[model samples]
Target chain A: MATTAKSRMLTGSKAMVEAIDQEMERDPRVFVMGEDVGKYGGIFGSTTGLFEKYGPTRILDTPISETAFIGAAIGAAMEGMRPIVELMFVDFFGVCMDQIYNQMAKIHYMSGGHVKVPLVLMTAVGGGYNDAAQHSQTLYATFAHLPGMKVVAPTFPDDLKGMMIAAIREDNPVILMFHKGLQGLGWMDQLDASIGEVPQEPYTVPLGRSRIVREGNDVTIVGIQMMTVHAMKAAEQLKEAGIDAEVIDLRSLVPLDRETILRSVAKTHRLLVVDEDYQSYGMSAEIAATVAEAGLYDLEAPIRRLAIPDVPIPYSDPLENFVLPNAEKIAEAAKALVNM
Target chain B: MATAEIVKEIPVEKARWMYETMVKIRYYEECMVQAYAEGKTPIFNIGAGTVPGEMHLAAGQEPAAVGMMAHLTENDTVTAPHRPHHHAIAKGVNLKRMTAEIFGRQSGLGKGKGGHMHLFDPKVKFACSGIIASGLPPAAGAALAAKMQGKNWVAVAFVGEGGANAGAFHETLNLAALWKLPLIVVVEDNHYGISVPKEASTAVPFNDIRGVAYGMPGFRVKDNDPLEMYRVSAKAVARARQGEGPSLIEIETYRYLGHFQGDPEVYRPKDEEAQLRKKDPIPRMRNWLLEQGLASEEEIAGMEARAHQEVDEAYAYARESAYPQPEEALADLFEPA
Candidate 1:
């Protein structure tokens, strides 16, 4: 919990900006463009001090045009510019999906490898602030379901910094979705696990790799982004109940870390996939299918998934909390899986 | 700035092609209405038809599609909204394959992966989305691609007047103007966004005026006249091809059918459809072509028969084609590595 000389404690947003800054300084082609990315320094603080450092040319402030700018990012990328465009909210993918899915995601393949779109589409995701249905969604499955793009959600500052650098460096389009609750913002509820010691130097966390945050012999609890933070908390709660729960952070969804998941499920007889995305046809179902496909015999108990029921995230505090996956709900599901 | 005299400037061959395209689009929609009603006769169960799901036929909006598409080449890109059959036909999408896709057959455009609303024909550089106003940004991207590659090819996005209220519309307009991309946004003002009239949903009477705020020229084509559409879109297309930037054109179009097949007419006025039918663009265009001495009555009748035959063959092809294998639904989500 304490910061040492080798590493300093950074919030998820600061770590993300640090990686972007380092990348911009390193590559002249690398730049940031989005709504409020300049002067305002990103409403979520993802681009905080970079605007002062990079100025208007590099850190361009766009006119809230997710489709045009995002599409322009694809055009620029095709023309040999590595643009790091931000979609203010993952929920806003609705307005610009044709650009995201049809253009950005498929242009490379559609062009038969003749073109490469190496743009990083970073966006704020997750629900907990009572922002309601329109604003609050972690639609990981929506992007992951489409084949062309890579989807990553990093919870801690270390992985946030490292994976962001990796996403920027990757040749394909990478969707870097960060959880709002995990960003360590002053206005929203913060997660302690989101604040961690991150090295100042640039590093790359390989995409498609899953990390086992906690090792246990009894049950496997799989999560991504904010759910990983919840899963870790649930692990602690289960530990007190004498249930050893293994927590796996699935940083990337498209090139899913199925091997780590299968390996973990093979070790622990029970599996519980927790997600903040919709329950049906989402991350939970995909993870469940992965285990069922190859690691079915390893499960001693039926695989359980805890996710938001197929409903829009509501506005009121009680309603939003009721639908979202928290430590309590995750602990309950893990406990039930262990008992079963 | 296209006046009535500009309508005369349209080449006779182009005018004839536009009329034939409108006729073909109307016949296609009419055939689809019958095809969609096949199994749902007495009970009217929406899920019972061969075309199973919701069907939104663009019967009365042919002029807008042919007007803007008349300027486009095979290399130019088009991104259309959900009610896209008219645009698809006018843009030269293969009718049989598109119909087969609509019928959920294996040989369809997306190989049955994408149904009616999600048709993607890369050969002609045409794609459409089911979501409203979502196509504008991608169309801009296509235009941006052309500009960056130093090509004269422009991209056109066809959206409903209802879609103009979406943030994507404003965003795309501003972005396209700022970047000086060769893009055209055509708003087919069909008066209703699924029963909510434009007055209730839009702050402005006309969406074209919004283009002025975005620093682009905006034009409105009155009364769904195909010739007028051709005239106004000609200027817009010329400006875009010259790298002058994007333009917005709003066509006062009409939707003759319900928003979707099987949608009860509870929200519509009793006499609206009948009144709209009185000024059907297809018949009006036919009369205009005859009066202009551009085509003989026999030529117009021949065009009508040919259009009907094309629709007939497409429907038959769709009916005879095999549905995609159930397991094959999992394919085409991503291209192969």
Candidate 2:
């Protein structure tokens, strides 16, 4: 929310495009290839202006062949090319799960350090505009369950730009899941924190890092991607009631910043994990398990996780809203934790 | 147009090299089969903890492997199917390392992680997939990189006739041709996919002709002959290298053994294997070598002995090599953060 003259105000999608543009300009081997990435400028606007800037060779548009294109990205990466490929939606992973999980994810590790797959698989995630079950999944946990790649979800423009650059420069495969609500698309409802001042100069936000957006002493609320925005809002409301709520935005999931989470929980001694992914065996469960295993003594109350119940995301707006965790739900969970 | 009788003049040196490669592949597979059987005593179990997993031996498919591989260079890449040993050897993968990998040793191509069906050798730009026709997409990817980088290198994908019926195969071929990528898709028609006959599984009479739907030239090299296989493969490879886009070349070959080490092969008609053995590419190639005066009887025997010796040495090395430690299984899941 900083309005200083020195910083450039950019939307999350624009920042992502700039990060990719900078990386592609720096390394000739780095290129973007995926469906609708060229003429359409990316359906989510994440690749806006990249086609006109880089031309056809670098900003290649592909057919709707996920198995072929994603598999091709793996082959190209094996041949010393740094390719940034976008899967249109994380929900569509079912069509080409073998290519992503078996080949792209397992190749580097199976090669016994002899080979490296420096590829970035970017996909759109989350649901709030009634995009339905197919288009509205935050399935980064599904990817993180497999042991090969890094999964990142950024809640703000600055974090998106920095993470995009870092993911492109990384030698291992990284999955960058952008929540639809945080893209600052004008047609869609935009969160105030989605658009912010970003550094014009290209930089990398280190992977496996967490940001404490709000610090407090009473409780620690862990969130990622769209859920982080709701948690921060809940914190603002809790402040009026004199209940101190700490909010943490988990930027990366694979090499999870457990130390930061543990440190915050040690101080607050009350935890509420919020995730857009489903409840059972998900990011929420993993975070809760981490706290219970390592920071058991610091817990002043039982850990609470507000996540989607085990059900497919529905297309109906009210039904979808009922399933998704929101600021109200998060604040209620926090109040319970504080009261306990 | 009538099927013109295509006559291709072969150089003596090239013919000699092809013969040598075919012999080497035959000997290597024979050794692996024997080694695999040695661990399976009177029981004859597929999973008796010797070679451990299913081994799909490519005994009678030498012509397709050597012929298509002869046009490849170190810079060029290839993706192979479940039956990949012949392709691996023909593609210039280190034999010692490949054998050790088959034995699950620590010094193998994937350090014992990938085993035989999933071998990946960066030196030779070789990779394989256990899934049917899954190799086509990755091969197209390598070709994509070559086209983007403006390199003359080509990538080859090897799939069986049954695999050619897969959706991925058709999709990849279409993409390669549409993008004008430097790729050659070789369909080795081996008559059977495990227990299912190619006739029952494949819709098209000729898998190569399926390329017409994708606007690419298609050719079928018939009769189990390596020289003919080479002529067709060289043309397809040249088409890819010249930026004429991808081509489909199907080589009619056969696998000498069952689908896997322990497959009963009840689906096949009686004595079908024995009948197909009559058209084995190895002896046919040997006869051509003698008729063309490319090698004397004594020199040919010497070459065969050398191949056997090479395979014997590889077998010994694999036997002596130590297996990867159990704790090492936890490693290589990802690059250290």
Where model 1 places Cα greater than 4 Å from the true spot, the runs are A1-32, A38-60, A65-84, A89-120, A124-150, A155-174, A178-206, A212-247, A268-340, B1-8, B199-204, B264-275, B290-293, B296-306
TM-score of 2: 0.97
The C-alpha stretches of model 2 lying farther than 4 A from their native spots are A1-6, B1-7
Docking class of 2: medium
Q: Top lDDT: which candidate number?
A: 2
Candidate 2, residues B143-197: lDDT per residue as tens digits? 9999888888999999998898877887798889889998999999988888888
Candidate 1, residue B102: lDDT: 89
* Lowest summed lDDT window (length 10), candidate 1 chain B: B1-10
Candidate 1 lDDT, tens digit per residue, B1-337? 2212234488888888999999999889988898899899999997787998879999999999998888789988898998999999999998998999888887777666677887777778777777788778778867876775678888899999999998778888988998788999999999999999999999999988998899999999999898899989998888888889999999999999999999897998899999999999888888888889999999988887898899899889988999878887454433343
What are the per-model DockQ values? Answer: 0.15, 0.63
Docking class of 1: incorrect
